[model samples]
Target: MDHVDRTEIRPCRAADLPLLDRHLPTPGAPTRHADRFARQEAGTGTYLLAWRDGVPVGHGQVRWDGCAAPGVRAAVGECPEFNGLDVRAELRGQGIGTALIHAAEELTRERGGTALGLGVGHDNPRAAALYRRLGYGPVVAYTDRWSWTDPDGRTHEEADPCTFLVRDLTTPDA
Candidate 1:
């Protein structure tokens, strides 16, 4: 927790690709970081990183257009969606993920959002508990579906059962 106190959260920069590749390589989705950066540049989303001792440790994405998941869109309207949160395997439980989520929440609030949404996979009770502790409440149950291109350019699809959640950013604790 003390180290988490020293963690810095900020938007992903062009120079971070290599650093991210070294520490957080998404081999199955080789161009993920670049694509997120492009979304950031396009003003449709934000890619945030958490740095500790000058090394990247965690990351998250905020889609300003809300979640593309149909159930989420239907349930939550257009509130910003916080997704793709990940922390270094060795750094889990150290608060890096929480810091990243806090940063994403602030980014949403700063952008005039009254609320923010996220999805917790049904099989991930740990994450569900964390989000619940963070004040996010379940909104809808849906299949979280998406596809990603592998390094070889083969596309793979995923459909995980999930519960969409939303938090009221207007509240002080949020």
Candidate 2:
């Protein structure tokens, strides 16, 4: 059996927030995982976390609607979106990311989403390739903008060239 199979993927819980923050720290800011967990608790969306031996190693979130890229938001319509996918640096290439993606897909399907979408940073070809391998096709290219607070609570905005990708969730094979 694969080592990744030994890892458990499940919805985020309040108890998991601290460990998530430790393992996936956001450098100069509060852990983004905490915010996602809050969103999960509020019933706005589902945040999935991967654990190995009681340690949080991966994270991803599925949004029922809205996307940063205008093209994707217009094209995918009401599809759920997978975002904020991250695996611990040392644990990459061990199937953690793939497992997180699969969990997100299953969650979207359970939510009655007929399709799922995601955006990949243009600078990150490796992630784009992984999405492609998982059956996601490019829909449009656009720029994404967002802001984050630094450790000192100073906010900064960022813009990145990105490609939006989508995959039909209506079929099991998709």
Which candidate wins on lDDT? 1
Model 2 regions more than 4 Å off? none
Candidate 2 lDDT, 55-105, residue by residue in tens: 888888987664746676777675788898988888988989889888888
Per-residue lDDT tens digits for candidate 1, residues 71-163, read 788888888999989998888998888888888888888888889889999999989988999999999999998788876888899899999
Pairs that clash in candidate 1: none
Q: How good is model 1 by TM-score?
A: 0.95
TM-score of each model, paired residue for residue: 0.95, 0.93
How many residue pairs clash (N, CA or C atoms closer than 3 angstroms) in each of the candidate models, in the order given?
Answer: 0, 1
